[model samples]
Target: MNARVEALIEQARGMTSEERVAALDALQELVAPPDQAWGEAWARESEERLDAYLRGDIEGEDFDVVMERMRQEFLVK
Candidate 1:
């Protein structure tokens, strides 16, 4: 590794766990920033889904039932 990265790693070692996690998150954002357009699309989709649910145009499933079904499909041998 380069000297700058080695220095940064050494500094990170001195940080608290939460501080290290914050630093890691900052580094990841620098490496690959989020897509603003995709985020906006998801926000619009979520709002539309919520409106449908509120209008009773779509029914919601129970959380526990969904989890049990997922476990049976994915975890059962």
Candidate 2:
């Protein structure tokens, strides 16, 4: 195994369960994509929604309401 990976495993082995969990969480967040994690998905969905509105595929929609719903649904609050 890689020396660094082995060292990391050894360190983790000494941590309490909670500390190990926190460490793994930090590592996952650190290894996430460079740009905002959901930025691309948000932008793509937004573009699709806008296009649908412009094309009259969606009617009488309250966009801000939907945005609020999305925020709540995504637990951004």
RMSD of each: 4.1, 10.1
lDDT of 1: 0.97
In terms of lDDT, the best-performing candidate is 1
What does candidate 2 score on TM? 0.42
What is the per-residue lDDT of model 2 for residues 1-77, given as tens digits with 9 covering 90 to 100?
Answer: 99999999999999999999999888987898346657888999999999998999997658999988888899855
Candidate 1 local lDDT, 29-54, one digit each (tens): 99999899999999999999999999
lDDT, candidate 2, equals: 0.89
lDDT of 2 at 51: 94
Error of 2 at 44 (Å): 20
